[model samples]
Target: MGAIGSSADNAAAKSFNAAFKRETLKGQKGWPSEREARLDAFHWLTRYNTRRRHSRLGQRSPIAYKNALPSTTIALTQAA
Candidate 1:
């Protein structure tokens, strides 16, 4: 936990931002409009969550790992 308004409170989000910049935004030509940017972000996020293999999840994409888990485990996690 971190104090309100502290950068530490956003450490995880910052890491994700860095990765998104590196993987999606950096070295790319800028979007022509806000709507284009929004659409690109949505596409990238969908690919990241459903297709990208995360090392922390044993090289499984998030959706794959979640789908592989037992129904009871999913239920318990959602209940929490």
Candidate 2:
């Protein structure tokens, strides 16, 4: 994407890691099981993508943003 060791290239990743640490990890030293950790991350990611409000998205979740868009499907054939 950018030149070697570019800050811009890592900006998004850094933001994500910070949020993950703050929200998912919640300062916990460790999980009781590896499966539990994975599941927790999965749940947090799902919630973040579907319910978390993002400023860049006009304070809407990704699912809400998508639902707000107008349909663009072209009609291929008339329905009976």
Tell me how many clashing residue pairs each candidate has: 0, 0
Candidate 2's residue-wise lDDT over 1-80, tens digit each?
45678868777878898998798778898789999999999999999989999999999999999999998989798789
Worst 10 residues of 2 by lDDT: 1-10
Best-fitting candidate, measured by TM-score? 2
For all predicted structures, in order, the TM-scores are: 0.69, 0.82
> Which residue pairs show collisions in model 1?
none
Candidate 1 minimal-lDDT segment of 10 residues: 71-80
Judged by lDDT against the true structure, how good is candidate 2?
Answer: 0.89
Give candidate 1's root-mean-square deviation (CA, Å): 5.7
lDDT (Cα, tens digit) per residue for candidate 1, span 1-80: 47889869988788898888787676987778899899878988999889999999999999999999987734345564
* Pairs that collide, model 2: none
Q: How accurate locally is residue 57 in candidate 1, as Cα lDDT from 0 to 100?
A: 98
